[model samples]
Target chain A: MSSTPVFITGLGAVSAAGTGCAATLESFRNGNGNPCTAAREETPIAKPVFTVGDPAAIANAEEMRTLRLATLAVDEALSDARFRKRPSDIRVGVCLGTTVACQLNDIDFYRELRASGQASAVVFDRYLRGNLSAAVAERYGFCGPTLTITNACSSGTDAIGMALAWLRAGLCEAAIAGGADELSRIPMAGFNALGIMSATACAPFDRDRQGLNLGEGAGILLLETDAGVARRDAPAVLTCEGYGTFGDAHHLTAPREDGSGLEAAIRGALTTAGCAPDDIGFINAHGTATATNDAIEGTVLARVFGTDCVLSATKGYTGHTLGAAGGLEAVFTALGLREGWIPASAGYKNRDTSIPVAPVTRMTNVTGRYALSTSLAFGGNNSALVLGRQP
Target chain B: MKTVLGVHGIGMISVCGRGIESHADAYNHTQSADSSSPIRVCRVADEILKDRVTLKKMRRADRFSKMSALAARDAIDLAGLRVSDGGIRLGIVVATAFGPHRATFEFLDEILDFGDAGVSPTLFSHSVHNAAAAYIAIMLGSRGPACTVTDFQYPFHAGLMTAAVWLHEQRCSHVLVGYTEESSTPMDRILAQRHRGQPSHEPVLFNFSPYASKMFSEGSVFLVVTRPDQGGVALDLDRFKTGNDRISGLGSLWAAFKDGGLHLPQH
Candidate 1:
C-alpha cells in the first residue's frame, strides 16, 4: 500500500493571464480575463485569441517558433517547482499531455521548405516530438524519466495522473506534469471545417451556445513525493486524490451518445479516490461548448452528481486548450480549492435544457473538501480527476 | 523488498530485419549512415514492411507506430500466449520520440488546403499518439492496460520503466514494450532549419529483444516480461538492486530475463 502523501510544492503556467502561477491564481480570484480580438485573421471568431506574445517580440523567435505551447507552460511549471539553477540531487520526472505540439510550426516550416527549397523554413526541430519534455528537462536540469501523453483532451489529466504514479512508485522525488498546445491552423481549420467553431464566444452548456473557439496555452503543476514535500517550506495547494482514464473507441471525434465511457472514467476516479458525489463542491468541466461535448458531459454530471454541483468551463477564459485543457483545468480546480472560492463559468447564461446540471454562472463560495475535474476529448478519450484538502 | 523483474519474449523490426536474426545481420553489416551526405537516413522502405506484415491498415499508421506495433506483435506471438482466450494478463506499451509526424503533417496539409472542411475524420483520428496503442489493442484484443508514452529521447526505455512499475504493482501479468522512430517531412524541414550547415541524419527505428543490451541502435524493441517464478526463466539483475539504474544503463534487465532466449548481447 502507498503510505506517504504527495504534495504540490510549486506550479508554473503560461496562460492568457500571464506566465506565472501567482498571476494565474490572481486572475482566477479576481476574475481577470485574457480575451482579445484576433489580430491576423479576418474571421470574427479567429480574432481575439489568447496569444502569449508576438512572434516578433522574442529574440531569435523564429528559430524557436516551432516550440510548443507546452514548452512555455512547462518552463513556468519548472520555475514554479522552485528548483534552484543547476541544482543537483533532485530526481525530477516530467510528464506532459497534448494533442499536438508545435504543430503550427510544423505546418509553416514544411510549407516554407516546400515553397522556397531553401532551409529557411520555420524551426521545426526545436519542438519536434519529445523535445518539449527535453527542453523542460534541460531547462530545469532534471535527469529522470520524461513522459508525454496525447489522449485528445484528456491528455493533460493523464499526464498529471502519470506524475502521481511516478511519485507513488518512487521513481522520482519530484515531477513536473501538465499539458499544452500552441494553436495550429490545422486544428482550427479542422474544427472550423467540422462546423464547430463558434462565430462569437463559446457558451458551454448554454442554450444559445454555438461552438468552441480554439485557443492555445499551457498549464503545469509541480508534484513532490512525501519526502520532498516534508523538506519544503510551502504548504500544498491541494492533494491529488485520484485520476482515472478511459477510451471509448466508439467514434473518433464524437463522444458516446450515452456518455458511458465518460461515466466509467468519473466512477473510476471517484472509486480510486474513495470519494462520494456529495463530497465534491465544484466541477471544472471540459465544456467545449460544442453541442456534443456539453450535452454529453452535462448529462453525465447530472446523472452522477445531480444538478447541485457548481459547474464551470474556463474555455471562455482560455479557448479550448485541447491537450492542455485537462492540466489547465486541474490547476484551476486546485486554485479553486485553495482559494476557497468557486469561479464563475464565463459565457454561460441560461443552462441548456438538454443539460439539466446547474452551471455556476457567477462567482460563488463553497466549503467542501473535495472537487472533481473532468475532460472529454476527441477519439472518445475520457478522464476524471479528484482533488481534496489534505488531512 | 521489491520483486525483481525478467524479460521472457522479444521481437523487433527496422530497416535491418525482423526478429533476432535480422538484428544480428544488420549490426554485423555496420549499417551506419555516410557522413559525407547532406542528409543521411536508415529508413525501412515502405515496400519491405508492407510485404512482411501483409496487413492493409499498415498504410494508415505512421512508420514509427507501424514498426512499434510490428515489434510488439512479434514479441506477443513469440511469448506463445493465446490472446483469443485471454491467458496472459497482457498490456501494450510503446514509446516514440515523435508521435506520427508524417500523418500529423499530412493532417495539417489537408486541414489547411481544404480549410478544415471535409478533412478525413480517419486521418484526424489516427494523428493522435495513442492511436498506435489503440490499434494494437484492437488487433491483439488486449483488455489490459494500454498506454502510449513519448519523451523525445529514448522514450522506449522510459516506457520500459513504466512497465516495470506496473509489474511491481501486480497490475498486469506480462507487458509488451516497443519503440520506433520514423522520419517526417516536417522533421526533415525542422532539421534543415536547425543545423543549416551541419550534416543531416535520416529517420531510423531501433528494435530490441530482452536478451540484447545492444544500445546505440535505432529501431523497435519488443520484450515480454513476466514475474519471477521458481521454474520460470530469469535474468539475474544483481547489479541493479537499487532501482536507480540511470547511470548503469540497466533499463533492459527485466527485458533480458523475460525474453527467455539463452544468449544476451554482451557490451
Candidate 2:
C-alpha cells in the first residue's frame, strides 16, 4: 500500500467503442457500443473486428499506430488534467503496456528483406527509437524513469500498479500510466489459432458466446502524488487505493482452473486497500468472452467476493482490446466511481449455470466508496486494482 | 532509515559459457561473435536440469525460456536462498529486448503458410512475452508475483527499479531479477549494419555517449537482489544517461560486490 493517496487526475481513451470522453460516454448512453468494421488487407482474418483509430493519421505518422494512439490519448489526458497549460517542476514518468505494436519483429519487412536482400527502414527505424514508453516520454518532454511493460493482457493494469510503486518510492512525483495496442494480423492470427477470436461481436459472460472479437485502442490515466496534487490544485478523478499482481505457473495460455492466481490477486488488492470484500460496489472483469476465461473468472469472483456481488464485464461493448483492455477498463471503473452507476454488460443475454454469479444485466445504480477492476492475461498473469471515490 | 538493497549473486549464459570463469575469460580474450544464426544458449540449463526429475515436462519448452530458467536457477544457487515457497511472497522480474523471437517467428510462419486454422497452439502460447517468466516460476515452484518487461535501451534498469521497490515495501523477502537477449537474423543484421564503424576487434565498453554506440549482444544476466544492510556490493548507479554503446558492466559490479567494492570500473 502507498503511504499517501495516489489519485487519477485525468483519463483518456481511443477505442472501438468510441474516442474521447464525450464520444465514449455518448456511445454508452445510446447503448450498444461494439460497432464492427471490415478487416483490413494487412489484418485479413476475415472476421469482422472492432478496429478503431484514425487510419489517415496513423498512416501519416508512420511512427507506428501504437505510438500515434498513445499520442492522441496522452494529449487528451494532458488537456483533461490541465497539464497542457500549466507547467510544473514535478518529476514525471511514463509506463506503458502493449503487445502487437511493441514487438520489433515486422513480418512484412522481414519477409521483404529475406526475399530481396533489402527492406525499407520505416518500421525498423521506428522500432529503434525505443520502446513505447520511451517514445511517449520523449514526445512529452518527461525526464523520469520510463518503462514499457509487455506482460500480455495484464500489461496496462500492471503498468498502473508499477507507477503507483514509483510514486511510493519517490522515484517520480507524477506518472502517465496506461496501455495501447494497434490491430495487426500477427495477433489476430495468433488468437484465431488459439481459437479465442469470435466471428461476431463478443458476448462476455453469455453461456452461448463463441469467443472474443479482437479490438484496438489506447487508455491513459494521469496519476499524482498527494503533495503534488495539493500543490498543483489538481482535481481528483478518483483514488487508486490498492494494487496486486500475481502469476500462475500453470500453463502458457490457460489459466488455473481453480482460479487460485486470480483469487490471490483479488485478495491482495482488498488487503492492501484495507477494505472488506463487501465494500466493493462493482467489478469490471477481464471477461474476454472465451469459455475458459469467463468460467474461471466467474469462479474466482465467487470465491473471493461471494455470489451476490454486483459486477459487469465491459469487453462486450469494447471487444477484447488485448493489452489495452486493462487501461480502458480502468477508465471505465473510474467513471463508475465518479458517476455512481455501471452500465449493463452489453450482449449478455444468458449466464452459465455452473458459475455462482452472473454479470450485471442492466444498468445498475450503486452507492459505495470503492470499485475493483481485474485483468487476467496470457502467461497466467493476474492483476487486480482497488479504486475509491473522492471523499 | 530505509533497508538498503544490493546485487548479491550474478548468473549468466552468453556465447562465452555458463558461470563467471568462462564469461571473464571470454571478456578478456575478445571472444569472436558467433556467426551462426539465432545465437544459441549453451547447455548449462540442460546440465542443471539433468539432475532434476522434472525434465520430461520441459522438453517442449523454447530455448528462450530454457535460458532464463537456467540463469535464474544458477543465480538462486549462488545466492543460497529458498524462493520455491508455497506462499505468495517472492517476486520474479524478467527483462528482455526481443522476447522469444524464435518462437514468435515460427508462429508467424505457420500463420503465413497455413492460415490461422493450421497454426499450432503450442507455438502461439510460447510467443507471449511473459512465458519465460512463467517458466522460471514453475521451475522454482515460486508462487510469487511475476512480470516481464521489454525494452532495448534500459531493460536492466527497469527490472532493478521494480525489484528495489518490492524489497523496499517488504513485499517479498528476495527478488530474482533477470535480463535476457537473444540473437535473431534481423537483430544481428541491424547491429552489424549500424555498428560497422566501431572497433570490433576488441571487447570495448559499449558506450552510448554522443550518439550511436551501435552494438547488441545475446545473453542472460540474473541478479539476486536483497536488502542493502544484509551485505553485498553497493552498486554505483549513475545518473540516468541517454542511450550509448557502453555495455552493462555487470561483471565489474559483481566483482566489486563480491570483493568489497574496491574495483568499480571506470566505464
Candidate 3:
C-alpha cells in the first residue's frame, strides 16, 4: 500500500445513542443510554434491544430496513463531506459491512415456502438487490470497486480497513465505508438460543455483566486520499492511519482464551502506524459484555497497553450492534480525538477484579494525536484501526 | 500501475469434479446439455464432497464450510506449503453470493420447532457467513487475517482485489482467496419460479445480455496467490476492475483458469 494518508472527511452514525454525529455526541456527553424491549411485533423474545428511534421516516416502503439504515448514514456522510452526491469525476468505492442484510433468513418467506412450496418473490427480490455496498454504490453513483464484507461482528472494521487499502492502492480517490444492520427476529432468536441475550440493558466490562443486548443502526465514514481531499478543499481533521486484522483459528463462536489473535491485530495496527503503544490516547474496545468476550479482551488490553491505557467500552451506549459496532466505535474514537474528550464508559459501575484494566469511569479530557478502536468478532476475527488527529 | 499477483496454486470442486486437473479435463471435453431435467441445475455430487480424512474434524460443519475447507486445503497442498511450517503468515479471503443458506434455514427450523430459547446453539453458530472462513482457518492453523465478502456481482473479483491488497501491504506471506456458494431448496424454488416456462439448457458462456436465461450452480474455487516474484501465472488485477461481464462469477473464472483463457501476463 502507498504511504499516503487516508483522511476521514466526514462521519455519520445512528444508534440507540441518537441519529447523526451531533446527536450521538450529545448522547455521549450526557452519558445516558436508551435501551428498550424489542418493540417489533415479529420478535418473540422480550430482551432489551437498542433500535433506531425512527426508520420509516428515512426509508421508503420498498427498501429493506438494513438498506434504509445504510442509506441514512451514507446520506449524512455525503452531506457532512459537502457533497450533494458522489462527485461525477472521481472514482469512489463503496465498501459496507453487514450481517443481517447479507442473509436470506426471512422467516415468513421460509415458512410460506415450507408450508405450500411457494412464497412471495418480494423478499427474494429485495435480498438479491440488498447487497449493502452495491446498493450504496448504485444510490450514490460511485464507479469504483464495491464489496459487502460479512466477517461476522468485525465486518465494519474490515470494510473500513479494506477501503483504506483501496485508497492507498489508488483504486479509488475516495470511498464510503462502514457498517449497517437492522433489528431482526432471526438474530434475536439465534442469540437468545445461544444464551447470550441479556434480559436488561447491557453493561459492557462491568463486574456483574450478564451478556449483550442486541441493537440496530449504521455508522459510515467518507474517507478520501490526500489528493482527493485537497482537490475538493475538504476539511481534514483526522486520518485513518492504519488497520490490522487476524484470525484466532480456534473456534467459531468463541474468541481464543489466550487473546493471541487480538494482540497480533492490535500490534499490527500500531506497527503499520509506526507508533508505539504509549502514543495512543484511548481505545474503543469491542466489549460486548458477554462473560467470555470481556474476560478475554480485558486480559489482552491489560497485557498489551498495560492497565492504565485509558480505554473504554461504548457498547454500553449502543448495545452490541453486531456488524455496526466496529464502524460506530471508529466514529466514536475519531469524535473523541477531535472533540478533545472521552465519555465515561456507560453502565460500568464496578470493574471485575479478575480483569486488570478499569475503563474510564467519568467523562475525561484527552490530549493526544491518535486513538485506537478494536473489534473481536465471531469466527475468531480480530480487527483494529488506528486513527490520527491533525495537530 | 496495476498489481500483478502470482497464482501459485489452484483448487476447485464443482459438478465437473474435484481439483484443477478435473476442471481442465472437463473444459477440454465439454459435455452436452442434459435435456432430461426441466431445470438445468449444476449440482456438486455428494461423492465429490466426501473426504473422511480432512473432514473428520468437520463432521458437524455444514456443506458450505466443508466445500470451502476442502478447496482451501487442496490449494495449500498443491502449493507445497504446510501450515505447520513456522513463519508462514497465511491469510484467507472467501467470497460468496449466498453463504450457508441451508444451515441458516436449518437454524430457522430449530427456531420454529422449538421456541427462541430452546433452539440449538450449534445450528445458530454455523448459520453465520464467516463460518466457512473460520473452518478453513482452524483446519489450516492459519492465524493471519481472514475476511469474507458477499456480493451478487463480482464477488470473486472483489476477493482477488482484497487478496492483492493484502499481498501488496505485506500482510501475509501467501493468501488463500476463493469463492463458495451452496444451492439450497429455497434458491432452487426461486430459480424455478423465475424461469417457470423458459427452456432448460446449459448456460451459454459469455452471454452478457440482461434477459438471458440463467442456470444456477454451486461449488467452491480457491487459489493460493503470492507476490509476482514467486514465479507463477501472473494475474493482472487491473483486468478485474474493468467489469468484464464474461468473467463475472466463480464458474467463469474457474473456466478461464482451466481453459488457459486468462491471458496471464508473462513475468
**Native contacts kept, each candidate:** 0.29, 0.53, 0.76
Please report the candidate that would top TM-score against the real structure: 3
Model 3: clashing residue pairs?
none
lDDT of 2 by residue, A1-391 (tens): 4567888888888887777866776666655756465665455567758767456645644578778877778888887888853355888989889987657557787677656645456777777674789889888888888888888999999998888878877888889998998877778777887788878778888888889888888889898888778887888758888888777888778898988999988988888778999999899999988999989999889888899998878887777777788888998898888887788888788878977778888777877899999999887899999988876
Question: Model 1 interface RMSD, in angstroms?
Answer: 3.4
Query: Any runs in candidate 1 off by more than 4 Å, and if so which?
Result: A1-3, A17-34, A39-48, A53-86, A102-105, A116-125, A128-130, B1-5, B16-24, B27-66, B80-91, B108-121, B141-145, B169-173, B184-221, B226-267
Q: Who wins the DockQ comparison? A: 3
Question: Per-residue alpha-carbon lDDT of model 3 for B1-267, expressed as tens digits?
Answer: 357877767888765678756654544544443343335656667787789888878989999999898989898887888876886889899988778988998887777788666777888889999999999999988899999998776677788888888887788889999888776666666667766777644543222111345555567878898888876566777655422123333344445555655553221
List candidate 2 segments past 4 Å from native. A35-37, A53-59, A85-88, B1-4, B30-56, B85-88, B197-199, B203-216, B238-248, B260-262
Q: By lDDT, who's the top model here?
A: 3
- Pairwise DockQ winner, candidates 1 and 2: 2
* Ranking, lDDT, top scorer first: 3, 2, 1
Q: Model 2 clash tally?
A: 11
Q: Alpha carbon lDDT of residue A244, candidate 2?
A: 83
> For each candidate, what's the DockQ?
0.28, 0.54, 0.70
